[model samples]
Target: MARVAGKVALITGGASGLGLATAKLMAAEGARIVITDIQKNKGPGAAKEIGGDTLFLEHDVTSEERWQQVVVETEKKFGKLNIVVNSAGIGTEGTIEDTSLADFRKMMAINVEGTFLGCKYGIEAMKKHSEPSSIVNISSVAGLVSGFQMCAYSASKGAVRLLSKSVALHCARAGYNIRCNSVHPAFISTPMVEAPLAAASDPEKARKRLLRMVPIGKIGEPNDIGYMILYLASEESKFVTGAEMVVDGGCTAM
Candidate 1:
């Protein structure tokens, strides 16, 4: 039951968290995987862990030059590019007034610009192949909702939401057979969420506070989001494009 068999996937931020979870799942499902991250130390190990036909490269998603190199490298190794998951991003907590201009710019650069480059270069690589292709951009529940302390993060993700739709529409109009979509997750148990909790005065209490927001009595796991990403990356979601898939545990419902 290889859902994504015969596909080649390049995942950003694959060193840990949701990206790592998705890499492992897709690899197990028989897709060749290319995992990239700024974490040069962990990226190679993660690729080795996924084992079969997996490659890891040190990457900075915000750099357009690096994006070109990665996509080229992916195709050079795998012969074709089929799926791309732009999961590399950062989260910063601050109010509009508290967040500095530099901080906001950095958020936009990584979360917004990085995804843009991934889509741009990923499409270039996939166009060479005549098969259907997919691009999954990892947004956040914050993209769909607002938080007092998530001004910069929310702005970046909100940009991702629309950027995905625009890419989808353009590709469809051009008959590229490439689908693009965004996935929004809430309170996933990843380093992105845990680091904030760990820094709190009481980590357990902070975790509970986040759980309360979910409306499901618990936070989410990385695989919770990874599964949705897999569906989008696989041919099962062939007709899906320009859609926002929310994996939140009823949080956005509230």
Candidate 2:
């Protein structure tokens, strides 16, 4: 049977990378999806490609009003929402001395504040349904460990990790039957990783250096993380909440 069959999932950043991959995977497993991204052009094509009860709405996660609208539209169209994927985020690198306050705030606004809003609205929407629901926030191994130059990024992601845990505890105590968890992925070959890798003098050499961090000898595929998210979105994870599932090929283990 389809794991998420008949479930309604709203995924931000669904135009590409993990969000797009998750949308495709969940749709194939019979979930209704709302693919939201700032990329107006790519979002529609993604929705069309899914070829089912899928929607693509241009979303700005930084805006609380937009989050409100997205939730309202989702409930109106799908009647109820069962899954929320806070996959919209950005990557930046700079030491504490080199990082500007503006850059740090921008990173927090989207990565932390955006995810905060996503959780608030997602919880509100998911609680309306009796069936078990899930909210999966896409964090990073940076949240668990650290990068010398990723001070602000790590802080933002760390915020996401803890926020997910708090959401889970709240829902469990409130008897909402909702599950909230965080997925931490490291060095996944996605558009988010493309620019950083390309910035190296030799992209291939940079790729190899990154691979050394992953004990599994892989940089990870979007589908790998997608599959993990699927399990969390499904009934299989009904007993799972307040957990941090790492899909980083053991990067933090080292």
Candidate 3:
């Protein structure tokens, strides 16, 4: 049997990168998927590729109204929501001194506030499910450690990490049968990072520099994180909650 058979999952930022990868994997595992993203072209295309009970909704993660609409539409189509993957995020490249208030706020609104809204509404929506559910927030290795020119990004993801734990604890204490956890990945190969890498003075050299930081000597594929997300979203992780799973190619091990 498929691991997530008969489940329904909502993944924000599912138009591309890790989010799209996870949506494909979950759908293959028998979960009905709803992919939310602002990118209209790719979002619908992804849903079509899944070719089953899947949907793509135009969404801005920081908007509370959009989140509520997603929840409503998810339930309307799937009858219940069993999993949520908060993969929508943006990154800024600047040290504290180089960072502007506008840049910092933009990162925070999309990364931090986006994650916050996902968790809040995810919990509310999951509660309606008659079965156990899971919430997986996509954080980053930067959230776990300090790095160059990633102050705002790290701070934003750090908030997601702690917020997941806090919400997990709250649900546990309340006896809500819902689990919440965060996944921290380091330099997963995705379009999100590709743009910044290409914009660097020497793109190839910059790519090499980033790869050197990973002890594993390679960048991660989208499916690497997708599979981890599947495990967390599946019934197999029934005992796990309020935890952070690091998928950083041993970057944090050093």
- TM values, all candidates: 0.98, 0.98, 0.97
How do all the candidates rank in terms of lDDT, highest first?
Answer: 1, 2, 3
Evaluate model 3: give its lDDT.
0.91
lDDT of 2 by residue, 33-83 (tens): 998998998998989987886899999999999999999999999999999
lDDT of 2 at 90: 96
For residue 56, give model 2's deviation from the true position in Å. Answer: 0.3
1-254: candidate 3 lDDT, tens digit per residue: 99999899999999899999999999889999999998987887889987796899999998999999999999999888889999999877789999999899999999989888988988898887569899999999888897788989999999889999999999999899899999999888899888889999999999999898899999899999999999999999999999999998999999
Q: Where is model 2 more than 4 Å wrong at Cα?
A: none
Kindly report which residue stretches of model 1 are placed more than 4 angstroms away from their true locations once superposed: none
Model 3 worst lDDT window (10 residues): 121-130
List the lowest-lDDT window of 10 residues for candidate 2: 123-132
* TM-score, candidate number 2: 0.98
- lDDT: worst 10-residue window of model 1: 208-217
**In model 2, how many backbone clashes occur?**
0
